[model samples]
Target chain A: MTTTQVAPAPPGTGTDRPAVAVRGLVKRYGGRAVLDGLDLDVRRGECFALLGPNGAGKTTAIEILEGVRRRDAGEVLVLGEDPSLAGRGWRDRVGVVSQGEGAGQALSVRETLDHFARYHARARSTEDLLAAVGLQESAGSRVGRLSGGQRRRLAVALGVQGRPELLFLDEPTTGMDPVARRQFWELIRGLRADGTTVLLTTHYLDEAAELADRVGVVAGGRLVEVAPPEELGAALRRETTVSWLEGGARRSVRTQAPAAVLRDLLAVQAEIPGLSVTRPGLEDVYLRLVGATPTTSEGALR
Target chain B: MTALHATPAEPRGLERLRWAVADAVAAAGRDVAHWRRQPAAVLVAALFPVLLLLMFTYLLGGGMVVPGGGDYRDFLVPGMLALAMVFGVEATMTAVVTDTARGITDRFRSLPMAPSAVVAGRCLADLAGSVVGLAVLLAAALAVGWRPGGLVPALAAVGLLLLLRLAFLWMGIYLGLLARDPSMVVAVQILVWPFAFLSNAFVAASSMPGWLATIAEWNPVAGTVTAVRELFGAPVGTGGGWATEHALLLAVAWPVLLTGVFAVLSVRRFQGLSR
Candidate 1:
């Protein structure tokens, strides 16, 4: 009997070790340090997002990891090889959809995808890629004629043609409409399901919450905090606020188990006054963390 | 679509070379498709030189005089061919700078293609367009009763013109990489017209006054134009100077030197760009 797995898993892949690993990475421009000793790790088959404000070193860090830019000092590894020294073999296993990047404007969308497709020995068919990115209707139009969001989707389409094990998407949905963003999320989900490890950089809070397995809040050239979207920050995350009236007095208590408290309260009486369960949402904690860290200097210097 | 990559390891031997060639060809083919998609732009680009050629032949031909006895049209044809080669240099630089500005250059550098493929592709694409432009100008010259003489010499003249173009493209690549923004290109574009006209590309260099004539003779464009004129059996610029007298030698030497210098500068610039 033959098993059907469309993606041919490369050797030495599917390991327990993280897909991306960086330790004390340092990069500077002029005299100012843009990335001052940043550390990060992205697990295999997980979507890790570096969420930050403008000039939080998110783009610089990602660029260094992608090997488009070099670091001043420190150890960095992607797929078990130092990115700066990695060869074409490493490139074959990694895909990049860089911000502000687009193929030739003079060429049609299909032609643009086809040109990039030729670089990969085993590439997705242009038809499948066009359909996947929802650009089939505009496949015949010149890249210059496409809208900004349409062009971005084409960039995403080109990035995934090689079926890379590790995909780097830098602000991939920055300009997409709500509907297009939803569609793009589905495409990323498909890649995640197929075991692709993704590293994304975005300032869009919802985009990060909707996709990232874990989000790292970067500021002051460092990751101030990192956790899953639902548990990003704050001591209040695990605690639920249980408020009610005890006898004639208004009372409130924060505890890990609101259900147990509610059951006990119901046993005491038929109804509890001002009964409400409240917990700190991811947005509340995120604003508190990112807003508190200083990232303004990086953008100003750049 | 099935295999993640062609090989688990870095492609060795023939596989590497095959893909390298494929990447360069694919990159070049992108430009070809661009022309096919926008025939109007291609037509305008191809016709601009022909318009200049026709205008000079009819408009200015009657009033002009070659130092040696020859029809002005005959002299202008070869000069224009060499000058037209300089025109494509700006296009190459614009392409390079635009790519850099759009982050397209960075994207290409991140790919798994051969190191030289990007430059090679641009050269191939520009060279392809240059050849077509040359052919159109030659046809226009023939229609205007200007003969470029025998096959052997004509082909050699075409070779020198293309060599001049190759030299300029390397310079374009270096400058374009440095500019990185389309807005910065206007200064160079404005300067190109004066640079082209200051040579013997339009009127004979000897026709200008003493010091100016000497400068025109030594102009790199003048050397190629004069050499091409000699090859086409037209009147060569008779200015008395080392560069003027040594047309054929300077024709080959200037381009070879320019190509060597700019290619090195451009490659070094590109290597340092990502950092």
Candidate 2:
């Protein structure tokens, strides 16, 4: 019940410490361990994205850290205190935007936001929140009547209104339109620019790549890989696959030197059919890391 | 606004009480806020007990009798008030189950707001609504020519009704947390009817068979009904049991006991929801 753990420095104090630290987090449902001894550390003032497939314990792990769900065994420190045992002061510094709809349907959009804002000693004004989240027009609309995207934006607004020291966002942009998604990214970027610590879990790799300082891929209840988006699957990224037509059959070679392979193929034939070099992007590296067969447009071209 | 990421420790004593009251008011205000957008729904819920009062008083009243000789209206009116208090429980359960099911309860829990704020707020809000419903039913009772005893006793009767309501509010809240799904509450709502009829809220328990009378007399609703009938100077039939003999005491004890039991159960269930 008690363990020595470093607490995150006060916001805007400019210290480098893990805003969230998890050690041996174990959660079981009906004798099946959803989170099997997962360990992770997300540093302060950075956006860390957790990527995983469905039922990979990403949600379970996030809820545990948020203090919404309990863990069988784990040492968790969010802003330096155990989430499950954390009290009001802990909740004050932590902001959570859980997945799915939780806003009261009876209240108007503005009213819903106002109600949550009262819980915080400091909070953004309702006008600013509505304007920032682009819900200004629907401010008077019932929460239940708003579109899915609008509701998601409202959730995001509620999460950040407290100007939390640590923010937990679970699939924040699931139902957002392209413009809304872009706007959401900008909003997050603004928060990060303020030295806020954000932990995001999302299915969209591009979203992870676009926003994450580092992305951690989780599978089977543990981190498969955690690295900067560019540095993720470096070995996989370094290898290039060259595919073309040979003897009326498609052929491909994965190699460190694709230029030499292309030149040698051209030396054999005046014009190489389907001669293309493909480097695995974040998606490919992610797909392969999660044990999915990474495919490229060239594969579908054939 | 003064930002409080600076205060690592929570405030103590009076400050904590201030937060508790403020948070409870805010959460309770949320329920009242719902009434603004859905006035019709609120009106219907308030008037529902009045409908039952008319039905039982006019249609069912002719066949009913008080054992010791009094107007059937006198006996039936007190019982109807208790019945009305029990009936409002459906509203309490539905609101709670819907709130918990839709994830608002989780959201409430996640906030830094006072720990007991949501529940106390719900208690305040529901009890306030019950007060309004009670007023409406009382107005209907007066319109129907059902007279009662002195104002002081009548006030005591009203207190008993509200106390019974407070107890059921916890009971409903407990059941709602247990179910966590609004659909499951439908079964409970259906079950309330048989529960209401089984109490002496309708006929005098003395008229039933010996065993049935004992069971009905012991029903909490019957305890409240019988106590209020005494308070209103109505015929409280001759029944030979500890429950009937001490109606006023049982009336107070039953609700207080139920409130303690269910409040603990509801809060514990809410805290363990993650498990």
Candidate 3:
């Protein structure tokens, strides 16, 4: 992993305008509201994650922002212009990776990227883009012949090939293995360093926590919470649990202050065996926000 | 990285046209790539019409009397050309249905290309594929001693056949977009088979019963097949009344009308895609 951190741009270095802004957005399908009056703002050069379960309107919101679907009612300003009425120039400034596999299965990896590169005035070189996505070896392989993870990496490569100012990636790593997922995260971080603003929706909670500076949890078509991962968990911080083994029997207790509990236990037992204080993680906060039991992973956010 | 190649200053109208053309070409190129990967399918589609031609000319050619006193092979060739056009509709429909089923259409919608590029490109590529299929069928007919009267007439017949293909392509496009599943396309195609078989493609409309003759004579497929027969110096029945007299005009008009109506409808449907 590259440890060098790119310094954040000075305040007011760029105009204080959002790359994507939506307010009072509503979308309905067959009289059922899929997105009910949702509001969001993604700043320039930030990786913002929209976290939600399936059917929570995450895909619908992203589709409307990409100008691929029309909202029933809303004010959407993508790059300072309404995407519904925006012209070709506005499209040129944005990049989108949809949920499906792209192009025909017969096209070679290089041919696919090269073909898309023609659509933009400025694009990354096909070679460098392929190398960045770790597809340099499969450049001549047919898309269908590549593995599922490779195809996904190619999809992401195509999304960013145009060097778009704003990019929408919906479940970009849905089928990738853990190593590939980590490599893709690094690639996304590199894009942020290059001044690209990204809006993403993912099923992986760890992905959201690791990649997103701020995460928004959406439930039942409404955004319920928006905050940094640590801050989100901060609310459950006081209710910590101290656990240990006594007389060869495991014991656990919830307390407001774990330090006091541990101090008193040590005074009696001299050195408590297996003493440990545990706090809630981002997963705990996420499960709570979505109204699910945190202990069991089943029926949690997908 | 080629240093981003200095953005060229392009004139506005020219730039717009250039982008549209590029998008169309890219789409066509993708279709062709798919065809290359599945050459067996193309070969099979091209062979069906040729086999029909040989069987009709050899087994049924002897006792049949062509209205214009010409070779049965010549009469069957033009109608076979029309059948080729009809048959290619399945390919178009299948392509559209496959794209929808695989979610490729949604992916294309998300791209920044011209709005009409996807459909336009698919139609154009299908048209080109049909032309190739027609040429192969023609080559097989020539080998079987089927020749048109002259080069001019032959080229004119080819043009009319292409118009018919374009008409059916739009119909296929409309149906392909409307059908919910690939199996629905198969069912619709089965319905069209009866229309294709009952037309003037194989036998003279005069041989049919009165009620059936009326339906076959007025059938749009019959109109095209009859018109192509006249253009290529093939035998079309004379006793078919006004339809035989104005077969050429009707042949040209059917495709024009169908193409115009369906193209407009498809474009309108495309505009409403955001819903």
- Between prediction 2 and prediction 3, the one with superior TM-score is 2
Which residue pairs clash within candidate 1?
none
Cα lDDT tens digits for candidate 2, A1-302? 12222344554564565788898989999999989989998888789999999999999999999888899998988877677777777788788898867788989999998888888878989999998889999999999898999999999998888878788999999999999999999999988877778999999988998999899999888898999998999998998988888779988877777887777777767898877789978888888898888444333322
The top-ranked prediction according to lDDT is 2
Ranking by DockQ: 2, 1, 3
For residues A151-192, what per-residue lDDT tens digits would candidate 1 score against the true structure? 889999989998888899999997889999999999999998
TM-score of each: 0.87, 0.93, 0.89
TM-score of the A chain in candidate 3? 0.84
The global C-alpha lDDT for each of the candidates, from Candidate 1 onward, is: 0.83, 0.85, 0.81
DockQ of each: 0.42, 0.49, 0.37
Interface RMSD of each: 6.4, 6.4, 8.4
Best by DockQ: 2
Q: For model 3, name the residue pairs that clash.
A: none
User: CAPRI verdict on model 2?
Assistant: medium
Residues B125-188 of candidate 2: C-alpha lDDT, one tens digit per residue:
9999988888888899899997778899999999999999999999988987888778887898
Clashing pairs in 2: none
Residues A1-302 of candidate 3: C-alpha lDDT, one tens digit per residue? 11222344554564567777889899999999999989898878788899987899999999899887899998999877677765555677788877777666777999888877876767899999998889999999998899989988998998888778888999999989989898999999999888888899998889998999789888878888888766875666556767788789877776666777777786776788887788777776788787775443221111
